[model samples]
Target: MPTAAPLAPAATAAARAYLPALTGIRAVAAYMVCLHHFNPFAEGPGLGGFLHNLLLEFHVGVPVFFVLSGFLICLRYYGTEQWTGRWWGRYLRNRVARIYPMFLLLTTLTFAPAWLAHAPDTTRLWLLNVTFLRGFFDAHKYSGIPQGWTLTVEECFYLWAPVAFGLLRRRPRLLWLQPLGLLALGCALVLGLGPLAYEGLFGSFRFMLLYTFFGRAVEFYAGMQLALWYRRGLLRAPRGPRGLYTAAGLGLLLAAVLALVAVRGQYPYGQEAPAGIALNNVALPAGIVLLFAGLLTEATWLRALLASAPLQLLGRSSYVFYLIHFGTIKGWLRDYVTASPAGQFVLLNVLAIGLYYLVEQPLNRLLRAPSAAEPAN
Candidate 1:
């Protein structure tokens, strides 16, 4: 296999800059997750049921976020010559500031009803959720803000990313083996412990892919590899009419996932069965890579649509939206919007925008700001 050429320091620094197209893609992925949770087509039969079932698998959006997280983190921090204490501190602080504040606020609000009622085990659940360790255990995985399970996965990646980047930087050749190593470990868990143990401890081996860093490491590896290729200017989307071919390839990948889901019948994909995990963790990420490549390289209609101002704003506020969309606000408004999926969708986005502006954005800025007492280094 041909090794990738080493990236120049200048090229690496350029890669660290923000990619607006990625933010746009993030908006799409977050909305896909929202629609999955909302199940706007829950009421209708036939076409509606089919669409609902397909959207159920839109949980692929979570993996998209995971892969994107890996890519962005690698792009920014990989290949550093020195790992100084201050650098590590800044890294951890940025990560915590980006994720924790909103998560803590939302987790507290989600569990407040049960906590107030003195529900059994509520305190224990709160401990797990607040610490972002709920994903480690089956009982608490779905306890508070059920969707927050993904954050646990995100946290795991953040925890290990710096270490992984350091090792990869020291031994660039190891990059080729990392994904296979993760895949081998996943297979070992499945074959040795069997599927049940994998699911019980790690979440669904098939659906949630053990809900741990190790289980889903391949997705992150894929993203990291993409970041490397991107830094080298090796990734390119098809141009002109050929861009349609790239779109078609993505469509086919989605169809393949849908077929796998359909084969599972009532089980639904990514909720149970190893087949779901296989397709989701593998095929879905491939599709996302293709879509991302298209967005970056081609001036296709879909890219234009995603790059639009509204979607860009949606992308920017997506994290806040993901945190709160399925919680108290949805429950409170369920009665009025229960009959209209479209209305529910619009309401969630509107509420998300308000929260982003009023709460998330301001808090994020404040948290990221340097302390007055800390002199600039």
Candidate 2:
């Protein structure tokens, strides 16, 4: 084996011992997103609709992704000095490599079918989608697909990630500034900028972008805060009793979900009217923070579940699954959903896992692999 050039000895040791629990979180968040999307269109058996609506309210799964990114990136920067090489280039390369290929692949698949069905020619929105700028406006008012909105926010983070890391690298303590700044921006946008979205001049640009990224960035920052706390040993989780932490975490998770349901249920997805809209913004951020905190707590049961082989494996391949599963599963089931919702949900899960192993996992490995049997970072 070739020995790689090392960072500081202590830093290298820390890197080697990084936890897989975070990957498990990725899997959990991705499943929430999947269930949220599936519930709106498909019907299912016992507790399916209930679970769908409940999780739907807490769709901070997307927000959770942002927080996790911030947390991990900040953790890496704090751990070593290798954080400063043309940071933007490296950030762009890795993010693009991680996201764009699958997005483009799925976009093609989705657009083809929708267009064939004589769905409106969303050429303008489609162009914005490819460029990762759909969130800049309601450029998604009529797009290639529904979930495309989340990609817009993801792109915004990717664009800003390098600068974000650079700031954190310089003043790690200033990490809090990132979220505070974003929260302030979100508030300002909601109060002042959101109205512009309704007005003619600005159209939907300010509200759309602000609502999407401005509000969501804080969740990512919250994740970063969690990472910082863990690093400094200031956020040690409760570990003595399994039942206590498990119950506490479950309660927090449930509260967050119920809160979302109470708010969003009043306004449903396509209502086109704003009532308690601020609640949606505030609730999602709070829910994600609580959910992640619960997942990362010192509870034995939660830890065991997160550390489980299956959850960790699914989480490891989650990015790929997120990118491809929608197209793959929907395409495969285009013929079957008319049968029964329960059947569809079961088949979707089975097929998603299978495709994850066959297509997504392999492609991800090949892209990041060094050689056989060696894991890719």
How much lDDT does each candidate structure score? 0.72, 0.58
Q: Model 1 misses residue 22 by how many Å? A: 1.4
Candidate 2 local lDDT, 1-377, one digit each (tens):
12223455554443344566667788878777776665653346567666666756545566667767766655554443234445435545555656666677667776675666776655654676688665555535325545666777777766666567557766777876886687676566556655665422224433543347765676667666666665554554556654554465456556656655655543564111243344344444555555555555655566677778887767766765676435544655766554565666556556557756776556655564242222222
What's model 1's lDDT at 5? 44
Which residue pairs clash in candidate 1? Answer: 202-210
Cα deviation in Å at residue 241, candidate 2?
Answer: 4.1
Which residue pairs in model 2 clash with each other?
66-220, 67-220
Model 2 spans with C-alpha error above 4 angstroms = 1-18, 40-55, 77-87, 114-124, 139-142, 169-173, 183-211, 239-247, 264-266, 269-299, 320-332, 336-338, 365-377
Q: TM-score for every candidate vs. truth?
A: 0.85, 0.74
Clashes of each: 1, 2
Error of 1 at 374 (Å): 20
Model 1 spans with C-alpha error above 4 angstroms? 1-13, 42-46, 183-200, 203-210, 238-240, 335-340, 369-377
lDDT of 2: 0.58
- Candidate 1 is scored at a TM of 0.85
Residue 318, model 2: lDDT of 73
User: Cα deviation in Å at residue 130, candidate 1?
Assistant: 1.6
